[model samples]
Target: MAKLYTQESPKQKNLQPKKESIDFILNYSKALSVINCKDKKFELLLN
Candidate 1:
């Protein structure tokens, strides 16, 4: 009888993001909020 040889499947990667990535996103949103506030103020001045 002949034996069959099969390759093993690869491992799956982590689905969740790391702490650094979460922190970066949070900081980015905060910065965008500041920019949005400035824009609102500028629009109010022009109006």
Candidate 2:
């Protein structure tokens, strides 16, 4: 496969977020896990 990522906008590049906000970081990770679990359940239903 050819290298897939093409380019990022300058704004997108500069918008790197801090990893040190303890509460915000934890909530963000929990949200991702919930979304992933929902997606997996959805795929199981489709089968």
Candidate 3:
């Protein structure tokens, strides 16, 4: 079991960066959605 765990540890570590990128993409989409909402509101005010 110890040997298995040692081998898997590097795989788990490699996944950390992928997780971070996913989180960043999620946050970026959220920001874009908020910006779109604000733009719509501004357009309504202009009209």
The candidate that wins on TM-score is 1
Task: State every prediction's TM-score relative to the real structure.
Answer: 0.41, 0.27, 0.33
* Model 3 poorest ten-residue lDDT run: 38-47
lDDT by residue (1-47, candidate 2, tens digit) is: 78869676557546656777776767765555322564473222210
The deviation in Å at residue 39 for candidate 1 is: 11
- Tens-digit lDDT string for candidate 1 (1-47): 89768787777776788899999888776555322564473222211
Error at 20, model 3, angstroms: 0.4
Candidate 2, lDDT over the whole model: 0.55
Clashes of each: 0, 0, 0
Candidate 3 has an lDDT of 0.52
